[model samples]
Target chain A: MSRKLNFYAGPSVLPVEVLEELQANIVDYQGNGFSLIEASHRGKVYDKVHNEAIALIKELMGISDDYSVIFLGGGATLQFSMVPMNFLVDGKVGDYTLTGTWAKKAYTDAEKIGKVHAVFDGKDKNYTTLPEASSVKPSANSAYLHLTSNETIGGLEWKHWPETGDVPLIADMSSDILSRPVPVDKFAMIYAGAQKNLGPAGATIAIIRNDLLERCGDHLTAYLNYKTHTKSNALYNTPPVFSIWGIKLVLEWIKKTGGAEAMAKRAEKKSALLYGTMAESNGFYRCPVDEKYRSTMNVVFRLPNEELEAKFLKESEEAGMLGLKGHRSVGGCRASIYNSLPEDAVSTLAQFMKEFQRKNG
Target chain B: MSRKLNFYAGPSVLPVEVLEELQANIVDYQGNGFSLIEASHRGKVYDKVHNEAIALIKELMGISDDYSVIFLGGGATLQFSMVPMNFLVDGKVGDYTLTGTWAKKAYTDAEKIGKVHAVFDGKDKNYTTLPEASSVKPSANSAYLHLTSNETIGGLEWKHWPETGDVPLIADMSSDILSRPVPVDKFAMIYAGAQKNLGPAGATIAIIRNDLLERCGDHLTAYLNYKTHTKSNALYNTPPVFSIWGIKLVLEWIKKTGGAEAMAKRAEKKSALLYGTMAESNGFYRCPVDEKYRSTMNVVFRLPNEELEAKFLKESEEAGMLGLKGHRSVGGCRASIYNSLPEDAVSTLAQFMKEFQRKNG
Candidate 1:
């Protein structure tokens, strides 16, 4: 299989070149006579890696001095627990928008640690659209507002940042980070799991407000302590070393691929191509998400039945296109065009979908 | 830089062959288009990876139904807190032998949850020998006895597993897990951070006696709950996917190289070669530890003065002998000859030491 197009939501696609770089260095790194993983995280070499990873996130997002970038473990799900644990001080609450599964997960876990106010949930509307900004009632005393910028499961996204006044906005940008140009200063904190747009599944990138870190609770364990990690800059413990290395290569890949602007343009073109194909797919293929809120990173659509979806997935797999099955929340197909999925792969997928519709419809 | 040896303790050297296999699959795995890291942990592909990783540990260890294996996040240090969290009940205490830094860490953290009996320490002797087993005073109702079988620091190791009567032995075999053969049924538990013998740093391998898991607290989080992982066979949460993948490859390498017996024989040969060279240098190069307890993995030695030690380290680095600096507790040169270090790397280091001694001594 020359280029097996992987459209899996996350633990998604990463560039073949990055892995080759890893392959070259897995036994020895940069003439160091040691695997990168074996090098000390506390040493100068790893210090550069950590600093560069943070710098790259900021560079890509074009963030300011006010925000501190943190690379972390536990993926985005851990952030679900961490956000409440850290930010929700005594008597404070967090306003969460339930856009889809990820938002719901973040909100539900938040309720266990602190008070949670559900601003708006598209759950009632079968999660087909994003919650309107007019309905979000940000409490004056709320610690912060948390939302998912792109809901991969529901194929919804916030086209515009919400107005939260003094209440800082936090966004889980796991699915769409770096896929387009995102305003760095709009959110108090933003986290994206690496599998989607960055590199692999073991690391998560966190862009956080420096001052907000002061409010993090001291009661948690050292490993779970955001304050401890924030204090030491994510070196409080032995980090996932190899995964961070992969992310470093991936960040370089992003820079070479023309930064965020070029990526955004390519992503828009790719999503437009796939969605256009789905639109012309007639009664055979249907997209459940509202057009305005559809995610540029993940294009979700459905066939008439599971059997047809199964056939589509199977035939697509045989035709060298895999991970085309949609998430369980939406029963169809989701072609996740993350940063690593070149525009050609997306076009190939679109071509395959078009041909499939031509034969089956 | 060709075939440079890795000496970064935990994320240290992996078998060179695993790197070759990893290169072939980085962008496309087994004809699957997407890179291995891009695959979902929830998907069947990763499930195969997870199974094979655990299966390899069992196969390599030659364990039976008495022991169950699981991979966890946060490395071995997390297990320092987690072992107590899961196994510490209202009335029970645990015994720990402070052989080196890791065991002391394990013992110190276990005290937070319950009672601890520190069996022995070589602090008085400046960690020159393994703490004598005769010094161990096992508690009548101790949950288990914990020991760092191979201490990467201080160059100490339990030459053999200690018998603690009715009390079960729990070993942190992080630096020595596939380096030697062991009777898996003898221990109540054995946990190793993958960076050393297994694969990468993200995953921790825990081999627990099935009956011991029943003692784990019921209220533990699903993520940290041993019972939760043991029941599902370590699929409790989205585990460290890439680490597990690498572990599978490492295990296959170990198998292809004739399993742990071959590994143990190779370790002895490499370590003996290095240690023999140290002995031949007499007072010029001094090994600080008792010869009987000297580790087969970490060979620690000192020069006549701090200047010579510094020069030795610097010149060694220039000569491609990396990670030779000793742990802070015992300041000197440390040559960590883990399973992945080919016999020639050790021979090269030994040759370098002799040449340096002839010129500098």
Candidate 2:
């Protein structure tokens, strides 16, 4: 059977090489006598994998000693709560820019812990574009400024980061991390769900600055405390061994296929091809997100009408292009061409989009 | 290559059938056009898996409608905090039994959240035996009474559950959840890390009664609150998809091999054989845990001396018996025989034990 082109957002798509390698070693990892999943986190095999996953993140992002890269569970959603619970202490306000559903969710989580100040909310504009950097003015006593670097549902992304001088910046890069070269030093903390650009759905990566560790709450549980994890090297509990190992392999693949810079170039090509097709469709296809803020990771567009949208989805699915259907909240079409999505898959979608438009128009 | 007789504490042995099935479908899950890991948690494929996993737990344990089986992350450690955070509210004391390392750890986590009362302590006896059921009496105003059903490191298992009427009973059943039949209704909530007797190391299974969930605090974070997770069907976030899917397969295997009853019978036979062998060894093999409270899942023992113990471990590892060494805190040897550990593996270990005694006794 032929491989289908997967375009699902967050639990998006992984490189075939990573999957093949994982499949080959699923039972016995390099003849270690047990599957990576079955290996104890405290043991040598899994310890190597755990450390290597961290090392890869550091190497790929050019991360310095000021930060600690941790592989956590419960996805980025857990981090949404954990970040605030740890940092937003003693009535310190967590300043947030509401770019999409996720940013708003993070704000909700922050409200549970302490004071929250919405620096800017894009929902008034139907979340069609990110807030300008000039418009973000956080409170003087704010603990940190938070934003969603990319909106999976709204298909909006920050072309440039908002300025939050002296207020340690935090970003939920769940849907777009590692897809391109990120300015790691600009943010005090950044987290991403591994399902998107990393490996699978079990692990979430948190790259936190060392000074942020000092801001953790006194009453935080051991598992919830970022400092506990940082001190224990993320072996505070038996970590998601298989998920972390999968990440190590994926990171190795990333290094082999040139670094983050190379990934950025590939993403640009795929996004440009898909977006260019939509732009030239003569009102046949419409992208709701503002052109400047359109996500390179998730390309959201619409056909002429609901009938055409239905027909397009059915036909594309038949042609083995899965997850092309848009998020239910934003009903249209979404071609989530994440980092691992080959250029050929984007090319196929672009060609199909034009052909379908010609027939329907 | 021959498969090693793996016996590590956690992230331990899985059924060979489950491993083989996972390896085959690591890339494409049941020809769903994408891997189980690559599928979106919101998609139909994952939705089916999420529901089925909950159903399987209920079926195997004979759980009633009053309970909700939740797939969570961060392992049982998170539950240690979550249980207290959710239940120990409004100045209510969390009553705990300090039975082993895990139990102490749970107590530590609870202290972070609210008032904790230690009903019983086992460290006086080197954690060799669980407290007598009759001796465990919680405070009348206790919110809940917590204990570890099986101590993986201490090699102790509760022969009878402590009576804690009205105050909800909670247990960390991490080491031996599905290894034998359990009185599900007796405990208001039970949680286990899914590395032993279930699946891999990413997902955690929490079987919580609805009444218990109603007791959750209003101030809890959305992800940390049991009410939030139960209301969302554990879809409060993107779940550990691969781990949950593996659990579905494991539960199916458990049912196919005759459910929890058959597992209990098998555990009895395996434990009897190993323990009986030790008993007949004329002080050659000494088990530290009291025979009445000895664990069928993790059997801890020692040889005549440390030198002999060292030699025994080396020889055993060379003969393909891994993880025979005991935990660092508790010196000597530990043989963890979970549900998936075949009778032959234990028999092989029993035979090896006798032979080693003959050589060096």
Give the per-residue lDDT digits (tens) of candidate 2, residues A1-361. Answer: 4778998886878888899999999888899778888787778888888888999999999999999989888889899889998888767789999888889999988898889999888877898988777778779898999999999888988878767788889999998888788898989999998988888888999999999899887688889999989998998888988888888888998899988889889988999998899889888889989988899898999887899999999999999898988888779999998888889998999999989988988
Error of 2 at A86 (Å): 1.0
Q: Which stretches of candidate 1 lie over 4 Å from their true place?
A: A23-47, A89-91, A111-117, A138-143, A165-168, A280-283, A328-330, B42-46, B91-94, B107-123, B134-144, B162-169, B215-219, B231-239, B328-330
TM-score of only chain B in every candidate structure: 0.96, 0.98
Give TM-scores for every candidate, taking all chains together and pairing residue i with residue i: 0.90, 0.98
lDDT of 1 by residue, A204-291 (tens): 7788888888887555555655676777888766778877888888989999889899898888899889778878877678888899
For model 2, the docking class works out as: medium
lDDT of 2 by residue, B199-235 (tens): 9889999989998877887887788888888898999
TM-score of 1: 0.90
Residue A262 deviation, candidate 2, in Å?
1.3
Q: What TM-score does the first chain of candidate 2 have?
A: 0.98
Place model 1 in a CAPRI quality band: acceptable
